[model samples]
Target: MPELPDVEGFRGVMQRCAGGRRVDGVEVRDAGVLRGVTARRLCRELQGRRFAQPWRHGKWLVTPSDGPALVWHFGMTGELLCAAPDDAVEAHDRLLITLDGGRQLRYRDRRKLQGVRLAADEAAVERILADLGPDARGLDLSRFLRLLSGRRGGIKSALTDQSLLAGLGNLLADEILWRARVRPDRSVRGLDDDELRRVHAAMGRVLRSSVRAGRVPARRGWLTGRRDDAEPVCPRCGRPLASGRTAGRRTVWCEHCQR
Candidate 1:
């Protein structure tokens, strides 16, 4: 899944590849990936307009122009790629945009679970965005503590809950809890003040570091690194990492390190 850091990286790609230059053309290769705006309307609305700086919230990326904005949600296997005109097309390139300056941007997704939406105005933008909680990268410790104080779900589940705090996915939730020394099964409200402090600090550190790296690095010394091994071992404690299911996704944790 393309998470916050991944979306942020794509935002950077949009800035470099499509910003400033007028949208000479927009080819909705697969109308299945577009929402609210038809192919003709998309081309008409964006064809002559220039793309501005893009913003992201949670896993959603917004590219605004003078008219309706293009909002993208990269589902489980989606990505935005920038390439030259003659570059070979990947099999799943669903939406392609051509700028007047000759560069091209392509949105590729194998499973088109969620795609694009066209928000007509700032008000419409707010309608779609109003429900998202504070972004994880800029989360405030005091506010996060307050939110956690009344939750009954497990720590990992709470972290992955987009309504509580946006931008965290399965890998990040597990990694953060592992670093905080909290078991995935531990209820959110069960955290003591010290434990909450540790969790807050750990989440901040993990999110910042991963966003800097442009993804959950899955590197040595982190749970993400060893979670997929045939017989995964804990990178933090050298103990065998356990795997099961939680929050309808595969869960990874080190029993030795996490309480």
Candidate 2:
């Protein structure tokens, strides 16, 4: 799934590829990937407009134009690629935007679970994103604790809840919990102040590293690197890792390392 780090990378791509450049045209290869706007309207609204500085909230990417703003939510398999005009299109290339400098931006997704939305103005954009909580990357420790307070769900579920802390997905939740030495099934209400602080600190470290890598990198020595092994073991303790569903997502944790 495309998480916060992945979306941040996409924001970088948009800034480098099409920032301040006028959009020449929009070609909707698959209209099914568009939301709240038709192919013709999308093309009409975006054509000849320049893309201003892009923004990202949680997993959403926003590219503001002179008129309607282009918002994208990359679902499980979605990605935005900057390609040459003559670059071969892949099977799932859904939307193509031609830029003034002959560069092209492509929205590709295999699942098409989420796609593009054209917001009429800044208010519309805010309305669209209203359901999301404070972005995890910018959330303060105080706010983080407050958000977790009174919540009765498992720690992993709370971490992955978009309404509470946006941008955390299955892999991120597991990785953060592993780093914090907190069990996935641990209840938030049962955590002490020290444990909460530890989890908050771990979240900061993990997000910074993951954003730099443009994804939750599966490097050796990291929990993510070992989670998929045939017989997964803890990177720190070498104990067999536990695997089960938490918050409706496959969660991996070290029983010994994470209490």
Candidate 3:
């Protein structure tokens, strides 16, 4: 699945390929990926309009045109591609937007799990996004602490909850917890201030490095690199990592390093 860093990378794709470009045409290769709006409505609303700025909230990306905003959520296997107009459309090229520069911006998804939608304005955009909590990259220590102070779920659950904080997926949740020396199964409400502070700091550190690298880096020094290995061990302590499910997502953590 495409997480925050992956979406951020797609936002960069939007910036370089679609920003400042006028919509010459909207081609729905496979309408299966669209939500609510039809191909005709999408073309009527977006064709001829220019994409001024692209924005992202949580896992959603907003491409503001003269009228409706194009929202994208890269479900399990969604991606944005820049290709030539005559370039052979891949098997998963669900939608293609022809830009003014003769290049095409494609919405590609293998499973068609999630893709594109059209929002009328900023308020409409907010309505679709209101359920998401504070973006993880922008969260502060005070707010992070307050949100986790009274949660009853496991620490991993609280970390991955979109209502508590957005953008963290299973891997990030496990990575952050392990780095902070907090157990994944611990109840959130029972954590001490020290643990919460460590979590906050860990989030910042992880996000900064991931953003810089354009993905959740699976470095040898980090648990992410080794969790799926045949003989996975914590880079920090050389202790073996364990696997289970938390918040309904498969999880991996270093028992010795994380509490």
Candidate 4:
């Protein structure tokens, strides 16, 4: 699954490969990966335009052009790749934008759960983002606490709720809870100020490191690295890890470390 960090990486790819380059052509190999726009219209709209600055909010990537902005959401198995014109076409390559100077930007997805959207203008782009809460990276501690202050669901559920706080997925929610030493099933209404502060700080730390790594890096010292072990144990305390489903998502936590 592509989360905030992975999408951020994709934004980097867009910047490096297509920024300031004129779009020579738009090839829609699979129209199923497009939303709200026909293949012919997409090609017509973007054929002569140039990509300006690229932006990312949560797991969504937006590339600004002279006309409509190109927005993308990489679902379960989607990625944006930059390749030479002569490179072999990938099996799952759904959309291809040929740029000037012989470079091509490819949108590839295996599951095709969520795909591309063409926003008519800046207002349309804002409309697309209207349903999402403040991005996790830009959310301040005060607002973060306020968002969770009176929430009714479990902590994990609250963290993973896109409407409440966008960009956190299952791995991120579990990792943040583990680092905060809070159980995933604990209710937000029952949490104390110290616990909230711990969670806020952990979110910042995890997002920073994960964005730099371009994913939720599974290191030996992190819970993510040990969760799938034969008999998972806490990396911090060496206690057995507990596994269960929270908010309908698989969750893992350290029994001793996260109380």
Name the best candidate (by TM-score): 2
Task: Identify the runs in model 4 with alpha carbons over 4 angstroms from their true place.
Answer: none
For model 3, the superposed segments whose C-alpha errors exceed 4 Å read none
Q: Please provide TM-scores, in order, for all candidate models, with all chains considered together.
A: 0.96, 0.98, 0.96, 0.97
Per-residue lDDT of model 3, residues 1-259, tens digit only: 5778888888999999999999999999899999999988998999899997898877788889887899999987999988999999999899999999898999999998887989999999888889999899979888888787667879998888887788988878888888898989989877888988998999889888887777789898887888889988888888778888877888888778787
Model 2, span 1-259: residue lDDT tens: 5999999999999999999999988899999899989999999989999999999999999999888899999999999999998999998999999999889999999999999999989999999999998999978899999999999979999998898878998888899999999999999999999999999999999999999999998986889999889998898989899999988989999989898
Clash-forming residue pairs, model 3: none
Candidate 2 lands at a TM-score of: 0.98
Order the candidate numbers by lDDT, best to worst. Answer: 2, 4, 3, 1
Per-residue accuracy of model 1 over 142-225 as CA lDDT, tens digit each: 898877877887888888888888889988888888899988888877878988888899899998888888888879888888
| Number of the candidate with higher TM-score, 2 or 4 | 2
Q: How does each model score on lDDT?
A: 0.85, 0.93, 0.87, 0.93
- Global Cα RMSD, each model: 1.2, 0.9, 1.3, 1.1
Q: Candidate 3 — what's its lDDT? A: 0.87
Question: Cα deviation in Å at residue 176, candidate 2?
Answer: 0.1
The deviation in Å at residue 33 for candidate 1 is 1.3
lDDT by residue (167-189, candidate 4, tens digit) is: 99999999999999999999999
